[model samples]
Target: MTITIVGVGLLGGSFALAVREKYPKATFVGVDASPVHGQLALAKGIVDQMKPLDEAVAVSTLVVLATPVNTILDLLPRVLDHLPEGATVTDLGSTKGLICQLADAHPKRAQFVAVHPMAGTENSGPGAAFRELLPGKNLIICDREKSRPDSLKLVEALFSDIGMKLFYMNPQEHDLHLAYVSHLSHISSFALGLTVLEKEKDEQAIFDMASTGFSSTVRLAKSSPQMWAPIFDQNRTNVSQALGDYIEFLKQFKVLIDEQNLKDSSEFMARANQIRRVLEGIDRK
Candidate 1:
């Protein structure tokens, strides 16, 4: 099989590397809107060749879109329009409802498989990619019934080869859970970075006193603003609702601290501590 990967940044580049590791016999081609990225991906051996978008689509057996959320939405229909007959196209976008809707009645609709691999680091660019990122990760395959069985099975096999655990969910549910677990976390990280940077006013003080916890929480702040701004904007309703709920929780905790309601605060913390156990379970899987 020949796989052409579009937008060779963190996600796309990493995916290319993953495919190379798991499907070494398969031909690989990388395409990116950024000429530099295409060159870098080639230089770094992420793909066998870098080709123009349309030509790549024409020849590829599978085409993966790993562009930013907004760009992915715009690119999907164009890719669908150009894809070879029976070619499979999949996306690695975080949010999915809009993309699913856009591809709903596409002529190659059966070839479209909507996927979000629940994996990433607070990094971007071809250089940031590594093959280990996808393994053992939970991948949500949204609305699989829309895809042809062969196309869906092919996608599933690819993810399985990379050691991914598959889960199925409708796009609407995926977006809602993602808003709380993924989108809201990024917002919290960005806001926390701004809050600390604004108050500290001294870079050295932040550098000297910051703990690992602080570093971990704010790491997502380093992510590309261009990629993330549109994601937050596109999923504004869901993200905003999650953010409001997060703020309310914070406010309640603040009030508890102010009132010296130590017992109540302890109970709240005990409940939240279940997250560590849940994460432990995931790791065990």
Candidate 2:
């Protein structure tokens, strides 16, 4: 089978590598807006060839959209419009609700499946592709009932072959949950990085005194703003709600700190420590 991947950047490139590793005989074609990325993906052997978007989609049995959320929203219907009968299309956008809604009325909607693979690093480009990127990570499929049985089965088998654990949810639920688990963390990291940079004008001091905790907490700040800005825009209402809750917690912690209430602070930390169990469960999985 030929699988065409659009965007051919970090997520798309990594997915190509993973698919090749698992399905050696499958032909992989890449489509990227950036000529540099297309060449790089070809050089890295992430794809067999790089073709124009419509040409790639026309010939492939499956097409994967791995672009930013806004781009996916724009491209999905067009892809469905051009796809041959019996071909399937799936997406790897971060936010699902808007994308799903936009495609709902299309005549070829059943040929499209809305998916978000719960995995990635704060990196971009074909150079960042790796075979192990999606292994053991959660893959969420939204509004599965809306997709045709054959189309859904093909997507399920494809992701399963790549070693992702599949989960199902409506698009609304998916967006709401991701606001807390994924989007909020990125916002917190970006805010923390900005706060430190503003307060510590001495870059050398920040470099010298940075601990492991600081490094890990600020890592997401390095993610591409070009990619994340659209995500935050599309999911603004949910993200705003999550940020408000996070800010309230921060304010409460500050109040306790100002009072020098050692007992209450200790209790707060103890409660937070319960996250260790949740993390351990993830690790075991």
Candidate 3:
């Protein structure tokens, strides 16, 4: 099979590596906006060749759009335009609502599947990619009924082959839940990083005094702003609501601290500890 991956960065390159492992005979063609990334993808053997979007899509049996959410919105329709009769297209964008909505209006809507692989790290670029990234990860496929049976099955099988668990959701539910569980964490990390950086002023002092807890908490702040900014924009409403809820708790906690209410602060932390059970359950799965 001929697969064309656009973007060819971490997610795209990692996915290509996993696919090649499962289907050793399958060929890969890369289409990336960055010349450096394209070259790195080639050197890493993530793809068999590099091609322009039009040329890549023309020869592809499957096209994986691993670009940013905003870029996916622009590319999906154009890919479908060039897709072969039996070809299937899928995206690995973080947000699904806007991308899925855009696909719904396309004439070849059935040819596309809107997927968000619940995986990735703060890293970017093709050099950071590895075949192991997708294994044991959950993948969400939104608006599944809108896709052609062949297209959906092909996508599901490919993900399954790479050891990913699949789940289904409407676009709205996916975005809403992700806002709290995923997006909000990044927002918090970014905010925490910024707060510390602004207050500390000395980078050397931060590194010298940093604990593992602080490093872990602020890690997402290292994530690419270019990729995350578009996601925040695409899912602004849900993200905004999530942020408001988070801020309310922060305010309540601040009040407890200000009043020196040890009992209330302890109770608040105890209540938050319930999240440990939820996280443990996921770990067991």
Candidate 4:
């Protein structure tokens, strides 16, 4: 099988590496709108060759889109037009509802699959990718029933072959869940970055005092603004709703502490401890 990976960034580069490792006979080609990424991907052997977008689609059996969400939306119609009848198309965007809706009535709609692989690092670019990233993580396949059965199975088999777990979700459900888990974390990290950078006017203070907890919480701050800013924009309503609830929860805790309500505070701490235990259990698994 020949696979053409468009975008050639972390996700696309990683997918190309995984496919190369699992299917030695497969030919992998990469395409990126950024000339720098295309050169880097080729030099790093992330793909067998590099090609223009239309050329990649013309020859490959599978076309995986790993671009930013907004860019993915812009490319959907043009990409759908260029795809071969039996070729499969999948995208690795964070939000799906909009992209899924965009591709719905296209003549090649059945050939496209919307995938959100639940894995990534706080890094971007071909150099940041590794083959081990996808293994043991879940890949969310949205609106599977709308996809051609064979195309869907092929996607599942490909992910499974690379040691990934497959799960199905509706686009709305995926967006809602990601808004809480993935999107919220990014916002928290961005806000935390601004807060600390403002407070520790001396960069040295932040460098000296940064501990594991601070590092963990603010790690997403290092992510590309190009990729994340649009995600927050696209999912604004839900992300805002989640952020509002989170702020209210923080305010409630502040009130409890300020009033010195020891009994309620203890109960609140205990409830939060349960989340710590749950996190520990997830880590163990």
Candidate 5:
């Protein structure tokens, strides 16, 4: 099959590598706004060739929109308009509700699949791509019922080939769940990083004294603002609600600390420790 990937950054480039592993003979054509990224992807052999969006979509058996959520919103309908009759289209955007709503009334809505692969690192660019990124990861397919059977089957096969397990949810539920699980973590990391930078000021001291805990906690803060800003904008309401709840918990913790309630703090920590079981289950998978 001939596959075209738009936005040949980390997600797109990694996906190309994964697909190439499973379907070694499939031809890959990459499309990106950045000429530098396109050239790098070609040099690294991430894609067989690069082409204009319209030209690439015209010949592709499957088109993967691996761009940011806002870019996906703008590109989905245009791709559907130019896609061949039997071709399929899918996206790897983090937010789903807005994109799904935008395509709800399209004439060829059924030709597209809404997917969010629940895996990535705090890195971007073609150089960061790797085949192992998707293995054992969960892939969420939103509003699967809206997609044509053939389109859904094609997407399912593609995820299966890349060693991912699938979960199905309506767009609304997917967005709400991700607000708490994914978006909130990035917000927390960014806030923590900012707090330390603003207060500590001593860059050398921070670098010298930082431990693994600090590094891991602030890791998501290093993610690209260009990509995440659009996600926060698109899922503003849900993410706001998640942030509000998190702030309330922080307030409660502060009250506990102020009161010197050691027993209460221990109980609260014990409750949070229950997350270990949930994390263990994921590890086993």
Candidate 6:
């Protein structure tokens, strides 16, 4: 089988590596805008060859779109324009609603399967990819019924082969839930990083005084802005709502602290601690 991985960044490169383990004979082609990323992908054995998007996708049995959400928006139609009959197309884009809506209008809609693998790190590029990233991760498959059974089955089996657990949801649910769970976390991290950087003019002081908790909390701030900016834009409504809700809670907490109400502040912290229980239960699952 010939598989084309568009973008060849972290998710795309990692998918190529993991899927190769499952289908050793499968040949991989990479399509990337960056000359450096294309060269790195080839050098790292992430792909057997690198080709322009149109040429590589024209002959592919499967094409995985792992570019930013905005790029995916522009490329999906063109990808469908070049897709071979009966071939499958799937994406690892974080936002699903608009992508799915766009796919729905295409004549080759049934050939596309919309997916978001709930995995990644605050890193970009093919060099940051590792085969282990997808294993044991949760993958959300949206609008499953809209896809051809064969196309859907092919994607499902491939993700399963790579050791990912699958879940199903509509495009609306996928975007809304992810806005709160994934997007909000990154936004909070970025805010925390900016807050500290603004207040602590002394970089050395920050480095010395930073705790592991602060480091972990701020790590997502280092994520690629090129990738995340489009995600926040694509899912703006949901993300905006999530942020508004979050800001309200911050306001409430500030009120408690400003009044020096130790009792209220302590209760707020105690309530916040429940997240630990929630996360622990999820880990147990």
> Residue 245's C-alpha lDDT in candidate 3?
98
Tell me the tens digit of each residue's lDDT in model 5 across 115-217.
9999989999999999889878999999999999999999999899889999999989999999999999999999999999998899999999999999999
Q: What is the C-alpha lDDT of each candidate?
A: 0.91, 0.93, 0.95, 0.89, 0.94, 0.96
Model 3: lowest-lDDT 10 consecutive positions = 276-285
Give all TM-scores, in the order shown: 0.97, 0.98, 0.99, 0.96, 0.98, 0.98
Off by over 4 Å in 5: none
Sum up the clashes in candidate 1.
0
RMSD of each: 1.2, 0.9, 0.8, 1.3, 0.9, 1.0
lDDT of 1: 0.91
User: Best-fitting candidate, measured by lDDT?
Assistant: 6
Residues 49-130, candidate 3, lDDT per residue (tens digit)? 9999999999998999998888998899999999999999999999999998899998999999989898889999899899
What is the TM-score of candidate 6? 0.98
Q: List the residue pairs that clash in candidate 4.
A: none
| Residues 1-285 of candidate 1: C-alpha lDDT, one tens digit per residue | 999999888888888898788787999988888888888999998888999999999999999999999998888999999988878999999989889999996878899999999998888999998888888888999999999998999999999888999999999999999999899989999999999999999999999999999998999987788888988887788999999999999999999999999999999999899899878987786
How would you encode candidate 2's per-residue C-alpha lDDT over 75-120 as one tens digit per residue?
Answer: 9999999999999999999999899998898999999999999988
- Show where candidate 1 strays beyond 4 Å: none
Clashing pairs in 3: none
Residues 1-285 of candidate 4 have per-residue lDDT tens digits of 889998888899988888789899999988888889888998888998889899989997898999999999988788889988788999999999889999996878999999998889999999998888887888999999999998998899999999888889899999998999889989889999999999889999899989999999999999999999888888888899999988988899999999999999899889878888768865864
RMSD of 5: 0.9
What is the lDDT for 246 in model 2? 96
| Steric clashes per prediction | 0, 0, 0, 0, 0, 0
lDDT of 6 by residue, 133-237 (tens): 999889999999999999999999999999999999999999999999999999999999999999999999999998999999999999999999999999999
- Clashing residue pairs in candidate 1 (N, C-alpha, C atoms within 3 angstroms): none
